[model samples]
Target: MPYSRHLGPLTPPAWHRPWFRYIDAVPGAEGAPPAPDPAQSAQTPPADPPAEPVDYKAKYEEAIGHSRQWEQRAKDNKAKADKFDAAEQEKLSEIEKANLRIADAEKASAAVAAELLQLKAANANGITKDERALLTGTTEDELKAQVAAILKLRAPSTASAQDAGITGGGSAAPTSRAKTLAEAVAARINKK
Candidate 1:
């Protein structure tokens, strides 16, 4: 009788719902497929979430490729920077050397001037005779020779306009050969 609560033993699960209850109650209907037992499905648990797909080969290759590129670029940049730094250091060294040369020349010129002044002061008649004589030394003659040599070394070359007869600060167009030779000889003596 309990099973007869339905029109028959075989009925669709959908027909057992309230919305479809009218279908079962229809007067001359035979029956439908039997509903599945709920206990059969209850014993099993729900499935786990789907796993993410992996591409190990692709990921490994990409990581290695990027690392190599980074290492190469790092080496290249370091080499370039070192090259420029070395060049810069060389340039700085050259400039320092030039500056040292200029400083030495200036100091030499100043010392020559100071020695000339001392010689002049020593020879001055205004000083006491005893103090003036006490200033006697080879310093005055030696400094005079050095100054003359420096002046001769710094003089204009033989090819200057003065020697080329080019007018304006130059020798006259008609200057005698003897005059030129005399000038050269005089420069040589002064330089010695």
Candidate 2:
């Protein structure tokens, strides 16, 4: 593009512009040192003086003190971290124990509910108390099935001798010798 003098002047000058403000940049510029003469250089000593000794021990001790302070801070941070970790571990163990207790309670509740259901089903089926203890099932249908099985097992023995037209078994004479009360007690004691 062609140069535009008007636009260039409108733009703000950057920090690196106006180079003439700096001193002694180029050789042979204004304020430049005069050329040295060989005759004056051989006679005069160098311009700068010798540097003094650096305080090495004082600097070394300060550095060591700063490093020790940082080390102590690191140790304090580690101790706090250890304490937090222990607290977290304790909370985790407590949570685990509580979860175990909840699981056990849930298991026991399920077992009791199942037993109650079985007993209710047995009672509804008109089962005897002794037979009800034998009933075992997790669901109503299974309990009903168990009750039916028990009833089926004892179906034949429900009738008495009167219903079968059979008699004389109740009044039969005893074949064994009759024992007195004292002899019965003595026998019972001996058996025990």
Candidate 3:
């Protein structure tokens, strides 16, 4: 009461206006503070913006086209590989055929060499070509047996018996006197 009585004659300052009046006032007042607009204060901005729509069908079609191209390339590569494999298989088969032919030729050569060796051996064993031609046998052993049998059947020479006055074709023996004379002549020839 004492302070109020002392300030009763003084007026209150204009700066003591209410807060709502200042907030409601218009902007650009002469020497006045700017005021906030009620409409701008009542509304709020959005947190995020809306996005444009995407074309999923077109993207899917492009991806499928690329996948098909890759699949076709893979098929082409597989076909090429198969073609090369067939060529290689054919070459291998040809090589096998050539090896078979070589083996047959070697076998034939060995057979011919064996036959030549057998012929040489037969000739060395005193078998004449004409006698061998007349002989009949399939193998070397059988041919040798035939040749031995033929040699056995041949007659002995008669020249020596004829010199001793013993006719080989006859059954008669030399007379004692003729034998004695032949022996004496043989002894004399041996001494000379």
Candidate 4:
């Protein structure tokens, strides 16, 4: 026989053999059987049959009814909102009227308070209510001056005492005479 060189083994090693065999195998090799037909597979259920034609008219009518219901609801909500707005306006008007009334009452109260203060001031100055009512002066100072003039006019005059013949009452007879005249004038005032 002729000499020949054996560079490698005829069959590959065990670890390399499986990889080579897998690559060499056919798509449907005997070791791995063919996949089951989709129609006959137990895992896949049959597809549903063709559905009947849609009833577009009935569907459109139902959609229209729903739309109408929504529109009516919107209208009702708007009506309620309008009613609430009207009520609020009425309440605001009422509040405004109440505010006006309050303002008027405050003005009246201020006037009464001023009058009361004037009356108190007059009373503090020993002016009686009846005397103040008879007095006619626009201001307190004028009223006070008028009251002073009236008091001065009502006071007994020295000329009246001299006319009564009541000179200085150093003597008992003149004193008695002065006392009598004074009593007579007091009695006359009381009678009036």
Candidate 5:
């Protein structure tokens, strides 16, 4: 026995009901032929056609499954792209840090070289620890010039006397010699 929706006895599909006409149901469809007149339809009626059952639910399910598979592929591709971007960013940061370290090392190296040059210059010029700060210049010629200036300013102090022996341009009369420091002081006051 065949399954039937109604509780009554099974009836043949041909005797069940008349099939609806698609063209007559929806009017004014674009590029469709005009609906036939009732008089003309009666004179030449369409022949009866058997209806075939269609699995619409199965078709809808198949479409949904296909769509899900594509969505999953898209998500996987996005994940791979995100991972690639993250790795690239990390590499770039490490390279940037390395560059900064190189720059710092270069700065330190330059400072040491300059300090060594200054030490060499000070030692060659016989500059003392106290006078080391007085020296200044980046090149050999400039350093030598500074050294010459320093030496000129630091010349022996004995070259000049604190008090003059003679003050006037004219010859003076001979004076008597004092025997003691007290006598010399008394003589200077008396002369004045």
Candidate 6:
């Protein structure tokens, strides 16, 4: 006559239901080999295969960044070289032009000097011609007399010691003096 038990009217507890369902659902899986519990397995913990090695993404990123920096430096160097080359070319062209101008100036100076020399010579010749023409206006007899007087004044005396013993054939003619005068006259006339 304690409190009447209600076991007959109550449904089964839910705690045991899942266990029963697992046991019933996996009877073939359990029969195969107890499923080899992970904790009890002797597979040597799989040795972790050397931990798959780290990716080192940061180090690779740093190396790539350095490479990019070096590339930029190379580009800058090339640009500088290009600029220098262009400037050098311009300087060279300027130098070439200067040389050409200098050459041209030298040629012009030479031409001018030649022309000046030619003009001076022409003026000299013109003056000489004018002097000669002015001298022609004098009396012919007077000019002849002056030339004869100059020749007589310049002639060696026949009694001079150098001419005294110099005698020609038979008549002792003044052949040597005449021949010398003739040669001088011929030379002077040829010079004209």
Worst 10 residues of 1 by lDDT: 129-138
Model 3 pairs whose backbones collide = none
> By the TM-score metric, which is better: model 2 or model 3?
2
Best by lDDT: 2
TM-score for each candidate, following the candidate numbering: 0.25, 0.34, 0.26, 0.29, 0.33, 0.22
Per-residue CA lDDT of candidate 5, range 1-192, in tens?
Answer: 565455566655654566733334354475456776889889984697777899999999999999999999999999999999888768777779799899999999987876677689889878788867755555566567656655554554332221222453333433222123234344335534
Q: Model 6, 73-137: lDDT tens per residue?
A: 99999999999988876878777979989999999997776555534443544434332322221
In model 2, which regions exceed 4 Å deviation?
Answer: 1-92, 157-192
Cα RMSDs of all predictions? 30.5, 29.4, 42.2, 35.4, 34.3, 41.3
- Kindly list the per-residue Cα lDDT of model 2 for residues 4-54, writing each as its tens digit: 455653433446476535444454565555667889999998898899999
lDDT of 3 by residue, 54-169 (tens): 89999999999999999999999999999998887687877797998999999999778656754765576676676554344445665565555445434353446654455644
Error of 6 at 124 (Å): 67
Where model 5 places Cα greater than 4 Å from the true spot, the runs are: 1-92, 157-192
- lDDT, each prediction: 0.60, 0.68, 0.63, 0.64, 0.64, 0.56
Task: Tell me model 5's lDDT, rounded to 2 decimals.
Answer: 0.64
TM-score, predicted candidate 1 vs. hidden true structure: 0.25
The 10-residue segment with the lowest total lDDT in model 3: 150-159
Ranking by lDDT: 2, 5, 4, 3, 1, 6
Candidate 4 Cα errors over 4 Å, as ranges: 1-34, 37-46, 94-192
Runs in model 3 deviating more than 4 A are: 1-92, 134-143, 153-192
